[model samples]
Target: MLDFINRVLGRESGGSKEIAKERLRLVLVHDRASVSPQLLQALKTDLIQVISKYMDIDEKAMEVTLDSNERQVALVASIPVKSMKRATRTPAVSI
Candidate 1:
């Protein structure tokens, strides 16, 4: 088989196909888990709120992502702490 020969030859091949396959595999995994990108965002927001109560965290920089592979939904959350500034503007008074 050509695929077998390519493998044995140690030549770089199938890169595009391999990348596409990997993407499809992850998409399928997310689909099966009933986890959507929106859901993942909501989860991330909630998680940040809960965790912030105990420690300082950077909600904007936080990354909560979902990936699917082979009927499995992987929820990945990366929370980092950083300096944040509070808004200075106050509510406008009616003239």
Candidate 2:
């Protein structure tokens, strides 16, 4: 609603510029990695699901990104966990 008005006014509609910039970054990263944006999204979704099984996460706040330097590439995940589950202990079996 408000975004429509901002667009009408020839303004960057409600932080859409930021969204566009981030999307562009994602595209660049994926292009360099030879992966499609859809593949990146699929990986992010899977990461969220797998991580959520062990923690209470703020799913909306999570971010997964690929970055590259002159020599190497990195896959980074920023997951905001509300609470992390403790590891369950098991007794050692005697021989």
Candidate 3:
């Protein structure tokens, strides 16, 4: 009720509590994904490399994370693309 009232009043409720709870949830999801910080960093680097092959992306703003709910885990990536590379074709060789 208070939360609803706060919403209607154009204010936010559960300020620090909500933030702490969300942080805890993220830690739990990351732990359940069995991904260490080093592993996650490596994955992020590899992803940037592979994605860079086809497009120009903002490395400083890229974000990658393992997210989860009660049912399953998900790998999420937010990459800001500056531009896409033009598609190129190679000549085919006859067997």
Model 2: CA > 4 A from native = 1-27, 86-95
Deviation (Å) of 21 in candidate 1: 2.6
Candidate rank order under lDDT: 3, 2, 1
Provide the overall lDDT of each model, using Cα atoms, as 2-decimal numbers: 0.74, 0.80, 0.88
**Residues 56-88, candidate 2, lDDT per residue (tens digit)?**
799889888787656777898898989976745
TM-score for each of the candidates? 0.55, 0.58, 0.74
Tens-place lDDT per residue, model 1, 9-93, is 9987778988898888767776767777888878887898787655678777888766654555667788887644353445478
Residue 52, candidate 1: Cα error in Å is 1.0
TM-score winner among the candidates?
Answer: 3
TM-score of 1: 0.55
* TM-score: the better of candidates 2 and 3: 3
Deviation in Å, model 2, residue 13 alpha carbon = 26
- Each prediction's RMSD over C-alphas, in Å, is 10.3, 7.1, 5.0
The per-residue C-alpha lDDT of model 3 at residue 40 equals: 82
